[model samples]
Target: MNENEKIREEILNTVNGLSDEQLNANPEKGRWSIIQVLDHLYLMERAITKSIADKLKSDERVQAVDKPIELTVNRDVKVEAPSYVVPSDSFQTLDEVKDKLAESRSAFVQLVHNADENDLEQKSFPHPLFKDLSLKQWIPFVGFHEKRHLLQIEELKSKL
Candidate 1:
């Protein structure tokens, strides 16, 4: 969790000082802007946090081996974003996106802090690319997911 928060702070800092126009400008046709990437991160975090909470509450339990989820940071492999986690096309400011990210992170942090470590270790959920990942792994998976997008954000900024 400590590492997760640190990565999140780094992500926020990466966008610091950019004007709203720059943040929201599309680097190229069909490509996401910086704010879009941030919005996607917020949406993904909220969905994952909700899924974790639901999985924790349910009786369904599945055991899975630990996956090399750290590979999530690799940009070589391209994975399409799931429709549910996709960001909206609406323009957004840095502060707006930051608030959304904060809200989602708050829910995620609360869920993990209150959850039983044993339960987190025992249960599992399916990731699009990673297949079934342990609930415990999903915690840091959020950070890795963001780290992946952070690179994208940097790329978008470079183009702008």
Candidate 2:
């Protein structure tokens, strides 16, 4: 399959077997559960859609200081995104979140395929954590972001 298709399949495979408790576990004070992570995925898909569809500036921002430009640069963001993401809403149930995640992920893949040179060339708003993640660079970030959560979910599962 092509690059977008490969990314789509990888996402489809990664999030397949989450449990309710695992989805609900907040991990720490004011953190997201797997369900929230799924929701964030959906939220991200929306952001990508908007960003690509019209070159629309990110109408949204993560919590904390909103260092969106971090996406454009290269920094270790695995810690910062979680640290800054103040949940706008409570975590939904696993079934609900995953269902939407699947759909949104497909949309994300479609968006990636539709991207042009500028989309790939233009960097994400500077993120507080990572830096230099241009649109093209962010492709891996898209997958990596989910994988990071999947690992977190699994680690949380190990304790349970």
Best by lDDT: 1
Per-model C-alpha lDDT, please?
A: 0.93, 0.55
For candidate 2, write residues 1-160 as lDDT tens digits: 1543454455545556756666577666665565665677677655655555544244442222222432432324445444333344564676676677678767766777776655456435443355434556555656555555556555555544
RMSD (Cα, Å) of model 1: 0.7
What are the models' TM-scores? 0.98, 0.61
For residues 1-160, could you state the per-residue lDDT of candidate 1 as single tens digits?
9989998999999999999999999989998889989999989999999899999999888988999999999999999999998888898999999999999999999999999988899899999988999999999999999999989988988899
lDDT of 1: 0.93
Question: Which segments of candidate 2 are over 4 A away from where they belong?
Answer: 1-22, 26-30, 54-78, 82-91, 122-124
Give candidate 2's error at residue 47 in angstroms. 2.4
The TM-score that candidate 2 achieves is 0.61
Once fitted onto the true fold, the runs of candidate 1 whose alpha carbons sit more than 4 angstroms away are none
Least well predicted 10-residue stretch by lDDT in candidate 2: 61-70
